[model samples]
Target chain A: MENFTFYNPTKIEFGTNKEQLIGQHLAQFGVKKVLLCYGSERIKQDGLFTTITSQLNEHGIEFIEFGGIVSNPVLSKVREAIKLIKATPVEAILSVGGGSVLDSAKAIAAGAKHEGDVWDLFIGKAQIKSALPIFAMMTLAATGSEMNTTAVVTNQETKEKLFIADESLFPKVSIVNPELMQSVPKDYLVYSAADIIAHSIEGYFTATDQPHLQSRIVEAIINTVIETTEVLLSDSTNYNARAEFAWASTLALNGLTTAGTAGFNFPNHMIEHSLSALFNVPHGAGLSIIIPAWMKWHHSHNTDQFKRFAKQVFAVKTAEEGIVALENWFNKIGTPTRLSQLNITQKDLPLITDNVLNNAKIFGIYHIYTKEVVNTILQDAL
Target chain B: MENFTFYNPTKIEFGTNKEQLIGQHLAQFGVKKVLLCYGSERIKQDGLFTTITSQLNEHGIEFIEFGGIVSNPVLSKVREAIKLIKATPVEAILSVGGGSVLDSAKAIAAGAKHEGDVWDLFIGKAQIKSALPIFAMMTLAATGSEMNTTAVVTNQETKEKLFIADESLFPKVSIVNPELMQSVPKDYLVYSAADIIAHSIEGYFTATDQPHLQSRIVEAIINTVIETTEVLLSDSTNYNARAEFAWASTLALNGLTTAGTAGFNFPNHMIEHSLSALFNVPHGAGLSIIIPAWMKWHHSHNTDQFKRFAKQVFAVKTAEEGIVALENWFNKIGTPTRLSQLNITQKDLPLITDNVLNNAKIFGIYHIYTKEVVNTILQDAL
Candidate 1:
């Protein structure tokens, strides 16, 4: 166990038809006027547009719409949202789609109030002092944007994919109606499961001497994801299974399991950002390819945690077996575990390595992974 | 596996020397004037008083002391604290001790604002809509007052032990420095462990259709408690073990595991209150004596949950063995299983049954536990 401070104020509502309460919850914070943000109008087709509009109308919550926040949530699109928010003066945000929509909305919600460029906050040059209270009708379970205070945005101009972490950006409330997820396509369901597993495995093997209770909490979530992801991948319409995966995915990166550990390296995420930025690969697929490769390369440094992971999650008799079991599970789910399958090459290795080394800096690992080692991990994945 | 809502906003700075940040965290909430609440003067003797005072003075925080609170905190004492608070007009409360001290502080914090009596709120006669912010430096982690929205207060006038649950009573911040538990007496440690287990048993067997994730969560806590309690019972100064128990107890009934569970009857608590109100036994001792007896009476109704409980927590392959194993564990900790061993008589069973029936109502068997059933359970315990 290690000394740590843990707190998360995000209120999560889980169940069917929970989306109907969104307008009422937002009204508690006195958020009346709103910017309804989304990606590619998928929410409109899924009936979220009508459900949310009817909810807002029933509650007399006024709002304007902003569509076309792209897959990677580029800086320009967020600027456009900031401009719309300034011009319209919407007091808060109502994001009604998946990760990209919420990510873009969170960035815009924070960036709208700041005087200077929003990218400054992403680069850590400025603090996000405050933001419009963001609300989510979470239609996707992948990015875990609802519970965590982290949001990743890409600067298409500089090709610098950046993440911002601040308490100010936490959504006032998140309405996670698992029924809303029944509309998500099969490819996305698979990708989302991979994303959730990556989140847990990184935290699991890297957490340093966690308190027994915290370690057990991580184990519980890992067991849940392992159990539920299979059910979800088998039938996307299995609402109970979808709900479990949704809840587990949210709990995975929501700061509860990271209570007393020092593993802050999101290398899987950092590397994935390169793939997502370079080629529009979904975030989960990028991580799925990189995770096992990173594990094989870095397993020596965290053998004990890996052994615990093996015992608790994969139920393998040994640590090595656990790693193999997890790899097989990912393979079984139609997610690519090798970089070649995702079309990366040696030419892009230096850029991906630079991107990871420039960002991923977890503190408690026995070895400091420099740029060369990052290249090796990426090359191994390839 | 069931519809639920989960949100806990208490900021916890955990482990050794984390108390140093108490001033800074308090400053965030804009508290300069403080009501320093505690039970005994153990902290004053152990140098924690000096540490807290110096830190407050260094940060220029004004303060008042209220050490009159006793264990299973009384209503009149709480009234006294409220009276003092009205005269002093402190900004917030900073409780430094175990759950009893913190629960008393919570009562005072809530009662300070209301025009009516505090006892009225405890007995469900009043709706307490709000409260002042309360914070605690949790030394003992038994009742989980450090991280929950419940406060159990004993009304000495009525000889009635009761509780009040409101969102307003949740601690603004909780500093859990496990190092502080080194000075906790062994008897207190053992009794507190008993209480933590009771929290889980009530929570786990409460609902038949409880989310499968919840069973795993409760099991994690039970498993951790079993391991850490054994270590701490032998060596009270085991900081890591103490810390593990501390976190487990907090999570046991803090709204997470019980979110979607139905019919969580605290028959053990209701039964324990009868003994506590009559004989002045330690609350946890009262609970330990009452729980297994109640289990024996009720296990046949929720046989599957009981069987699962036996398998997970007691590690008994059979349901009967699991019940026996739990009794053995309780006896191993030096607590009695029978009511007669605790000096209660059959003549008292009816009155205790009356107390339990008239007071709180939670039933795992989904049938309202009438006075006759309550008497039968108490009679069986004897």
Candidate 2:
């Protein structure tokens, strides 16, 4: 096992009606006021907004509402929120939607405290030293943003989707009421499943020092996601399945699966960020397109891990069969697995490859994921 | 899945030579002075003491030594340290040994801040609301005291082995350098393995609201412990095996395996604590003896979970086989698996049963673990 420091201090309130205690949770932290951030009007329509506000009032907490964050959360929206936060400073950021809103809230939190452009923190030009505390009432499960420190946001002007990770960005508390996720659209559910699997497999197959225990944990997560996703597809209201899926997603990228594993990169996320930035495809759909293709190309680089993944996760005999099994499962769940299904073709390969290469450079993986490698993987998707 | 709040704020520094940075870790918490706690003089003989003190000196930190803590760590020792701490207050308690020492350190940390008898915190008379900061450099992998809020200590006068769990008692930081554990005596290693497996199964079997995902995680931890223990027995110097075992032990009881599950109790620990309190048996050895006996007596109450455990961990078709398999494995590892092996006779059942019943009452499980039930389990052990 490789040396690693594991420290995630995010307190999670999980189960039904956990969001109702958001005000109490914040109050414990002495947060009297917060910038309430959300993606759309869906939460308001579903009565979640009123529920949260009533709880806030009950606890004598105040909030400034800042809605309209979107998936592939944009930098402009974050900057606007930061401006609002600076003008009427809130003690913390209360994200009331999915990963997108929470991601944006983290960016705004850091930007509110930062003296320079917040984008500088993402591009490695500046470090995040301090930020307003973050709390989340998660309406979705993908991205694992509720419990982790990293936040991904896209600069619409530059079309550069990037992330910043620092200890200061970890959420103080995250409420994951799986019941809140029952209303997620069917398409988004499959996409979330794919996204969670993507999170689990990146380090599992790519890590140079793959400890058996870490590998088992990753497999356990993937198995849970696969099982729960299938159950949710048939019965979205199955609370047990929804709870397990939500937790599996949170654990996928919450520093638990990747700890003690060395030399691993998020190639799937690296490539999918470009798709979200350029084509506006949902992150998980983009990953569903990229993962199998990348696996087909990269399996030879780590054949043993692939075979182990095959036997342990898919109960398949070979790496090829495992890849096929996963692809079939994605198809069964109605998640797009081909570039054509995503309306991208061979002609679009260059643009996607170039975007991915740019991200690889920023991610410090350009030496391995060069333009050639990017194009080849994209071609496999085609 | 059940409603739960999952909040573990302990920071873990895991890897080779992590102990060398203990002073820096303490400094990060602004601890200028610590009461260094340990078990025996063996650490001194092995250069661990010199290494730790030098690191403290390098970081300009001050410390006072408190050594000679024993396994089944006594409340008297903790009270002594607490008195010393009150007389010459320190910023934190730095535990430099295994679970026993760390458990004692946590009690000392709580006791130092309390005006009442420390035993009040263990029994139901008082609660621990605050404590001096605690840090640990672990040289053992059992009991999982490194990253948990709970601390177990035996009251010598009352012959009660009780534990206190509070958010305030969670270690500020824990350094888990598995290399430090490579020198563990073989018997202790086997005992530790038994203890880890015991920790994993307690929640796995007893939880009435068992989430499948949580079960999978428990299985993963158990499988890792079983695999790593076998490897370590053959090759104690195997770094990766030691690292995996240490990490698995930590994960077994660090609130991960039991999260989202409800209606669970640590009956194995409950029974084993009585043994430790009454006869001074090592915690793990007592557990190995009591586990199979308890399983034999209680499997029918949670038969489905037993069957699941049978298939998942032992690959057996029946719960009976699963219980036997675990017992055989314990025996194979040189840990005692029956009361007779522990030098106890059937005639001693009443005494052990009475002690366990007293504990069950304190644990609020007297209705389920009645005197008859405890006696029956003890009779089975014999």
Candidate 3:
């Protein structure tokens, strides 16, 4: 284990119907007004939007409505929300949808506090010194965004999916009502499982010094994601499975899994961002395509951890068997195992490699995933 | 899984040399003057006290010193500290020792803000609504009071050991430097191992609905504690093992393990408190003596979980074998396996049972560990 500092101040209100108390929580935190951010009309269709606004109204809280956030959330949406927040004075950002909404809300929160463009923070031109407090009522369980200090957003013009991580962006309070997630489409649920697993394993195999306890925590998250996803697929309304999956997803990347892990890298996410940016594929789908390929290419670097993953997660003896078992499980869960399944042709390899190299540079992982190395990984995916 | 709210707001500054920055952390939190609490002169002999006071002096922070907190800390010490704090205008209680010091500091912190007697809060006569902010630099890893909201204290006069758990008791910041724990005596280390294991497994067996993920986490903690304790016992200065053991101890009881387990119980701790209160035994030693015996008594109620614990933690097949294996491990690690090892004879059973019944009534666990049931468990310990 390596020297590290672990401090996550996000307060998660996880349970059934917990979303109904979001307004009360915000009020208790003295958030007088908030910019309510959401992705699609599904929350409205489910009457969740009405409940939230009514609760706020009953609490004597004021809010400005900002919707239309989309998956692979873009800088354009973040800019729009930032402009809205600038025009008005809101004390906080209340994200009422999924990861995309929370990501946009975080970007807007930081942008509203900074004098420069929000993209400046993502591109490392400026630092996020302070931001409006963020609160959330999550309707999805994929990104672990509710309790973390990072957000991913696509810069459409530049064709880049960039992220900003700063201590100031962590949500002050997040309400995770797994019951609200029962209506997630089967395909989305499958993709969410992949996303959670990706989070759990990314650091497990790459850290220079992985603590025994941290590895066990990562395995716990992986096991929970696999088990709960299977149950949720067979019966979507299984509340226990959904609750377990939801909490496990939050813990997967809330900084607990990688606390003492020095030299840990997120190369899979570094490569998959290119897939999402260039092809507009769902984040989890992009990961499913890249993970097994990356794992195979990188397994030799950390053979012992790979073997441990095999034994603990897949009950297999060899690293090769573990990678195959994971790939098979992804296929069983309806996630794409190959880039070709998403209809990308062999000719698209160079474009994907170029995008990934740019991300590698941004993430400071270019030393490991050089242009040629990324090309080989993409070829493996094909 | 059950509907639950998971929110732990304590900030942990974990890693090497973290203790050296305690003053800066307190300053950042706007603490001007603190009631510094600790145990015997070990910190003074080790120069840690001089280092802390110098850091505070450099930071221009003021403090009032309180020391001599012992293991299984008593209410009289807390009351003495509370009287000193009331006379002074300290902003927080800065604990500089292990769990005993932290527990005593927490009692003082809560009592300073309450108008009534502090024991009233522990006895269900009052609630803790506010407290002076608490901070800590932990020198020991057992009894995770650093990042939790609960503190146990024995009433020397009544011989009634009790605890008070409230959100206000959670420390504002806790610095855990495993190097500080490297000098722990081998016996104390073994007892600490038993304590960590007890915290991990208590909820695992008693949760009404054990989520697969939570169970895996419990097993992970148990595995890490067992592995790390063996290494530390041999080498004594192996930093990695010390760090892993320290961290696992914190996570074992920081509200994460029982997050979704609605009806989880802590019968082992409930029973062990009495042993400590009546016999003046070390907290972890009492736990080691009572754990296997309690498991044997309670295994029939949660047989599958016990079997799973056996298979995962010890690679055994049956619950009975698992219990025996754990008891053997305890004895191997130098913890007391039988009550008689502590010079406690069969004649002491009635006195111990009476003390445990008082604790059961206080903890509201009488439904599970009734007087007769606790008597049976204590008798089995003999």
Candidate 4:
């Protein structure tokens, strides 16, 4: 294990009816008013919006609404939402939806105090300092955004997607109710499971020198995801399955998996971001399609990691066979592994490669994944 | 899965030379002056004391020193430290040693504000409303006081050891460098490993339904400890082994293992506290002796949990066999599994049983471990 630092300060309140208690929790943070940012309608009709609003009223806390955040969370919309928040004098951003809206709310919190464009932060022009306190009542279990400092957003005009991590942007509190996940569509649940698996494996297989403890944590999370995903895909309304998935996914990438490991940059995420940016695919679908291809191409970078992954995750014999098992697992869950299957044209592959190279480079072992290498991976993926 | 809520708010600054970053990190918490609390002269001689003090001077922070805290930190010693801290007028408690000193420091932080005796909080007579900001440079791997809200203190006069837990006692920051743990003696290392395994298993075999994700997490941490401990026993200077052990032990009881599961009140802790109070044994040794005996006596009470523990941790076919395997594992690690091996008298057994049952009706299983149950487990241990 190489030297590293780990710090995640998000306070997670998990269980049934956690959202209803959010009002009192906000009181603990001393927020008098909030920007109630979410996607439109689903939450409101389900009575979550009213329940939370009533609770806030009970505490005499006010809120302004900013709904209709799209799946990709475009930059212009973020700017407009920031404008809306500023106009309302909201004290914090209280996001009440899936990853997209929470990601947008994070941007909005940072953007409200930012001097220049919010895109500057995404592009590494300015460091994140203080932000309006952000809180979340997470309805989805996919991104682990509720516990992590990562926020991914898209730029419409440039057709570019990127993520910015700022420690200051961690949610002051996250209310996770697994019951909320039951409202999600089956395909969405499957996609979320794929996303979590990708998150755990990236941290697992990329270690410069793998430690047994870290490997065990990675394997456990992966195994839990595998078991719970099967249960969830079969019955999305299974409360126990939802609860297990909700906790597993959150713990996977909330800085726990990457505690002391080195190497293995999030190459899959970089590639998936390219897919999501140009083709408008679901984030997890982009990952589900990219991971196996990237794994097949990159597995030899650390054969031992792949062997461990094969045995621990899929209970397979060899590293090569494990990759096949992963592919089979994804196919079983209806997450396509090919770019053509995700409806991306072969012409777009080179651009995806170029886009990843233009950004940050991943470290060690597979130390030579340049533009050509990335494109080769994309071609193999196609 | 049962309903539960989990939250850990401690910020862990981990890596090589993380102690040097402490002064800068503490400034963010608005702590200009700290009461530097630690055990013995080891930290001073080990160079951690000078390095931390120099860093504080570099950051323009002031501190007052208080040392000589012992194993199983006593309430009277804590009171003496409290008097010193009050006179110094520091805003925070900076603990620079193992869990004992940190636990004592937390008690001082919580008790300094109250009008009554600090022991009141220990005996459950008072609630900790607020605490001075606490920071730590961790030199120990067990107890997990770095990232939790619990402080266990022993009352030497009464031979009573108890703990106080409150949200306020959560450390503002904890700096964990695997290098710090390198200097720990081999016996202490094995004892801590046993303690970590006990912590992982204490909740692992709880009386809960569908604790899938949580059970996996418990196993992962325990398995990590078992593997890393072996490596450390053979090669103490191995960085990878130390890192794995450090991370696994911390995660063992940082509230992750109990998520959405019925909490098993720590029976090992209950039994061990008496041993620590009377004999001055290492905290982990007491736990190592008590945990397996408790498991054997209580296995029939919750066969499901025991069977799961068997399947996961020991890879045994039956719960009864798993109980035997656990006892053997303890012996293999050079930690005892019986009371008599520690030279604890038969007369002392009843007193320990009486103490444990005075608190929990059900010690660890689904059914209550009343006085009769406690006697049975203790008798089995002997």
Candidate 5:
């Protein structure tokens, strides 16, 4: 086991109607006003916006609406929200959608506090010393952004998808009402499943000193994600299934599964971020395409962990069978497993690789994930 | 899937030499002075005291010693510390030993702030609304006091080994350097193993609405505890085993395993606390004796979960076999699995039952854990 400081202070209110208490939670935190951030008008159509606004009014709190954040959230949208917040400052950021909105909220929170460009924080040119308190009413489960500090956002001009991590960026409270996620589109649901599995496996396979305890937790999260995903596919309204899937997604990247594991990096996420940045594919869709491809290429380097993952997660005999089982499961769940499925071909491999290389440099993994290595993995997807 | 607010805000610094940074951690919390709490003078003999004091001096933090806390920590010691703190107030309570010391520290932290008797907090006559900040450098793993809100302490006068749980009592920082635990006596190591497994199973079996995800996490913690305990028994100096065992112990009761599960109560701990309180048995020893007994008596109530536990943790076909396997493993690890092994006779059943009934009442499970039911479980232990 490696040395690690595990300190996620995000208070999660999980279950049905938890979003109704968002205003009370904010009030408890002493926030009189918040910048209500969301992805689309879907929350408004679903009555969630009214529900939250009514609660805020009940608590005598005020809010400013900031919508239009999209998946694979962009720096431009985050900057716009930051600008709005700067003009009419809110005490906190109330993220009312999925990971994208929450990630953008975190970015806006930091950017509103920072003097320089918000993109500077992502590129490591400026550190996030502090940010406005963040609270979330999650409408989706992927990205684990509700509980974690890191926020992944794409810089449109640079075409680079990067993340900024700081202890201060962790949300003060995150309301994860799985009921809110029942309305997620089928594609997005499976993509969330794939995304969660991606989060679990990255550190599991790559950690140099893979502690058995951490490995067991990763397997638990993956197994739960896989089972819950299958259950949700058949009956999206299954509250237990939805709850478990949402929780599994949150735990996947919430620092619990990766703690005490040494030298782990997000190679799959690194590559998928580039795909999402360049092709505008959904983040989880990009992950589903990249994971198997990367696994096929990288399995030899960590054969023991792959074999363990095979037995533990897939109940299969070998790493190769485990990879195949995962890809098959992804396909069964209606998530893309091939570049072709996303309408990308061998011709796109170079562009994807270059974009991935840029991410690799920013992630400080360029030494290992060079252009050649990335291209080979992308070709495997082809 | 339950409606629950999961909010553990304790920060854990886990790794080698983490305890050496205790002063810095205290200083980070703006604690200029602390009442350093510990058990025994062994830490002094081993130079841990010198190391801690030097760090305190270096950080310019004042400390007043309040040692002599013992295993199955008592309310008297906590009261003494509380009185000392009330007389000469400190910024925080710095616990420099294992769970007993930390549990005492939490009690002290609460007691110093409360106007009534400290035992009132335990018996639910009073609630802990606020507490002084707490810091801990744990030399032990069981009880998971390092990263949880609950603190278990025994009242010497009433012989009620009850716990007080409040979010306010959570330590500001906990330093878990597994290296510090290497010097633990062999008996204590096995006892810690039993305690961790006991923590995992209570919620796993007793929860009315057992979520598979939570069960998986509980199994993961149990599997890791079982595996690491065996490893540590053979090679106590093995850093990886110690680290995994320590981490597993922390995770067992840090609210992760029980989250999203419904209607779960700590019957094992409830009964074991009575045994420890009445007989002054070590917490884990009492647990080892009670767990199998409770399982035999209660398995029928949650047979499916028992079967799942059988297959998942013990790889057995029947809940009976799983119970037997766990008992045999407890015996194999040199922890007692029967009342006779603890030198308690069948005649003592009524006494233990009466004490347990007292706890059940306080725990609000008296309807289920009637005197007859408690006696039956105790009889099974005999």
Candidate 6:
């Protein structure tokens, strides 16, 4: 255990039909008018858009819309939204989709207040001193973006996927109605589970000192994700399973799991960002491929935690068994378990290595992840 | 699982040396002058008071001091502090001690703003819409008043030990330095452990619908409290044990363990409050005496969860074994597990029962706990 601070102030409104109250929640935050952000036409096709707009109107709140955000949300979309936000008189950002849309909204919220490019904040050239209040209605559970201060956005032109974390970026209010997630396709659901597991394990295996209590919490999230994911796959409309999985995913990355742990970095996320940035792979698909490979290479550094993870989470005896079981589970859930499975061959290794090295540099993990080390990890993935 | 909105906005600064930065934290919250509150002369004797006052002065903050709060804090102390705060120019209430001090600070923070008696809020005659921002530097790990929106105060006049929970009562910031708690006596430490466990199990057994993930979280808190309590009892100066215990105690009552659970009532706390208010027993001592007895009487209503507690926590085969194992553990940790151990006898049962029935009415659990029912549980404790 080490010195740490734990402070998350996001208010989560969860349960059936909670999303419809998003506008009223924002109104409570003094958000009279707002910039509404989302991805795709799915929400509109499903009538969620009308419900949200009617609620906002009922609350006497006005809004400007910025649609078409994409998975692995791009810098260009955030830039466009920032432009609209700056031109309009919106008081806050209301995100009405999954992680990508929420990430974009956070970026716009911060960038709208800054004078420079939003990418500057991502690349560390500038700091986020303040951000407009952010309100969210999450239709998906992965990434834990709704309740955290993390936002991952890709600069398409630069071919870089990076994240920014500032306490100011935490949503003022996040409405999580798992019923809105019932329409998600099967592949995304499995990928979301993988994403959640990835969140839990990154610090579990890498922390310099993992306390017994923190380990129990990480195991709790992992067990819930594993149990609920399987149940929801068999019956998509299992509302209780969806609710559990949704809440577990939020807790996985919401600053609670890593409290009092020391010297942990998201090495897996650092490498997978390149796979998403360069090949445009889905974030969780990239994670499923990278995690087992990273585990194979990094298990010796923290063998005891690895063995514990095996015994507690997988009921296995050794670290190797745990890695194999996790990889098998990913494959069983229809996610890509290898680079080749994602259609990336050995030929793409150098570019991915370079991209990962850049991320390692940005994240201050370059000492442990030199080009040779990254190459070897990618070779294991291949 | 049920429809729920979970929103806690307390900012916790946890770790070594966190208490020394309390003034700066309050300054960030725009507090210029604070009403510093604490219990006993222990903090002054231990030099913690000087450190806090120097830090506050360094931050150019002014403070007025109000000391001498006691365990199972009473309404008269709160009223005195509220009068001091109202007469002074304090911008916030800063508590520096254990749960009793923080609870008194919360009560004063609410009372300083209202014209009527603060007891009105506890009795539900008036609603708490706002309060002065509250801050804390905790020297103990029990009751979780540091990061929650609940304050339990004994109205000595009415002979009622009751609690008030409003979102506004949450401290704007709390500093938790486990090192500060190293001076706590062994009895208080064990009592704190019992308090933490009591908070975790209240919702675990009584919720109408308990989701699997919520169950896992409750178990995690219980396991952590149990594990750390044993270690700390033998080695009070162990920093890691103290840190884990402190963090786990905070999570136990800060709305994380009970999220998504429905129709739960704090029957154990309701009954224990009467024991404490009537006899002036320590809060956790009352809980330790009441819990096993309540379990013996109420196990049949939620038999599966009781069995789960046996298997998961005590590694036992039945609810009876579980209750005995817990009572044994409580005794091993040096807490009183029976009313006789605390020197209260059968002659005291009627008054305790009457006090508890009043609490049952206050907590809206009268249907579940009539005077006859309360008598039976107390008889079991004998």
User: In candidate 6, which residue pairs clash?
Assistant: none
lDDT string for model 2 (B104-149, tens) is 9999999988899899999879888899999999999998988899
lDDT of 3 by residue, B165-253 (tens): 99999998999999999889999999999999999988899888888889999999999999999999889999999999999999999
| CAPRI category for model 3 | medium
- The native-contact fraction of candidate 1 is 0.82
The ten-residue window of minimal lDDT in model 4 chain B covers B358-367
lDDT for each residue of candidate 4 in B207-229, tens digit (9 for 90 to 100): 45646777777888888788888
What is the C-alpha lDDT profile of model 4 across A1-382, one tens digit per residue? Answer: 7776667778888888778888998898898998898987888889998998998999989988888998978998899987786676788899999899999999999998887788898877887887899999998998999998989999978877888788888998998999988888878888898999988988787667666777777788878888988887778778888888888889888988787777657778877877787778998898988888888888887898899889878888799999999989989989888888877778877777766665434223244667677877888888
Query: Which of 1 and 4 is the better model by DockQ?
Result: 1
Candidates 3 and 4 compared by TM-score, better number: 3
- Model 2 misplaced regions, further than 4 Å: none
Using DockQ as the yardstick, the better of models 3 and 4 is 3
TM-score of chain A of each: 0.94, 0.99, 0.99, 0.96, 0.98, 0.99
Clashing pairs in 2: none
Docking class of 2: high
> Scoring only chain A, what TM-score does candidate 3 earn?
0.99
lDDT tens digits by residue: candidate 3, A48-165? 9999999999899999989889999999989888887788889999998889899889999999999989999999999999999999889999999999999999999999999999
Candidate 5's TM-score reads 0.98
Residue lDDT tens for model 5, A296-350: 9999999999999999988998999999999999888899988898899888887
- Candidate 6 chain A weakest lDDT stretch, 10 residues: A19-28
Q: Which stretches of candidate 3 lie over 4 Å from their true place?
A: none
Tell me the lDDT of candidate 6: 0.91
> Residues B1-382, candidate 6, lDDT per residue (tens digit)?
6988888888888998888788789889887899999899888888999999999999999999899999999999998888777777688999999999999999999998888999999999998878999998999999999888999999998899989888888988889999999989998988888899899999999999999788888888888888988898889899999999999999999999889999999999999999889889998999999999999999999899999999888889898899899999998889999899889999999988988888999888999998888999999998
TM-score-wise, the better of 1 and 3 is: 3
User: What tens-digit string does per-residue lDDT give for candidate 1 at A1-382?
Assistant: 7777788898999888788788889788887789999887777776778988888888888989898877778889999889877877988988888888899989998999898899999887789999988898788898788988888898877777788878987888988988888877777777888888788766666655656677677788777777877786677678777877788778788887777766456667767887887777888888888888888877888788778888878767766788788788888978888888878788878877765665655222224677777778788888
Better of 1 and 5 by lDDT: 5
- Once model 1 is optimally superposed onto the true structure by TM-score, how far is the C-alpha of residue B100 displaced, in angstroms? 1.0
All candidates: DockQ: 0.71, 0.91, 0.80, 0.67, 0.91, 0.83
RMSD of 1: 2.4
Against the true structure, whose lDDT is highest? 2
